[model samples]
Target: MIIQLLLIPALVLAVVSSLRSRTSLRGQARRKILAVLTVVAGVLAVMFPNTLQALADWTGVTRGTDLLLYALALVIIYLVGSTSVRFREQEARIVLLARQVALADAALRHVEAMQARSQQAADQAPVAAHRGVEGTAAAR
Candidate 1:
């Protein structure tokens, strides 16, 4: 009873917080709902050991504890797999973002270089014109 009292409100708050978040609402709600349900199920299983035993008996398992352990192991494996997949997806997004940043930087540098070259050419044009006038005067 104490566990449910503590966990239920905490899980509800988590779901509420997720709902308020700016992320994709559907995904966040789905994940939070799954998490709350999993916790509730675990708490129910712990509270009613007899149910676990009955389930084990029906499934040909010798002990409720063994069945519980197997179920936990499978849950752990699934969570790990899902976490790994999310990590890889985030990694790929980071790589793509980095590429975009690099390309932007390169383009900025090219523009700066072109501007500098244009300024240099403009500065030399006046000097070249003055030198040509001086040469013609010397010829006269």
Candidate 2:
């Protein structure tokens, strides 16, 4: 009775959160299906408590609750593994994007610097030519 009070709400919230999570369309569909199945199974368990016990007996488990605990453990393990892989993939993509942005910025800066240098040289050319002409006249 006490366990049901705790586990039912926790499981429902977990499913709700999973459904609300951002994922691909296919992933969202899969989670929605899983949530529906979870609710149906929960309803069946509440309506026929003896069914779980019979299933436990058939599966060679000592009790239905223990079987549930075992199943939960496997799920937790799988979620952790999948989350780790997803996190690593996201991290790699971020690093790649950062590198791309940095390279693009550096390239832009280099082009601007070259343009400024060329403009400075262009501005100085007339002054240099005037100085050369004056020197030639003074020498003559």
Best by lDDT: 1
lDDT of 2 at 100: 100
lDDT of each: 0.74, 0.72
TM-score of 1: 0.71
Listing every candidate in turn, what is its Cα RMSD in Å to the true structure after a full C-alpha superposition?
A: 9.1, 8.4
Number of backbone collisions per candidate, in order?
0, 0
Q: Residue-wise lDDT of candidate 2 within 17-50, one digit each (tens)?
A: 5434345787668756866876787688778878
> Stretches of candidate 2 above 4 Å error?
1-43, 46-48
Find the number of clashing residue pairs for candidate 1.
Answer: 0
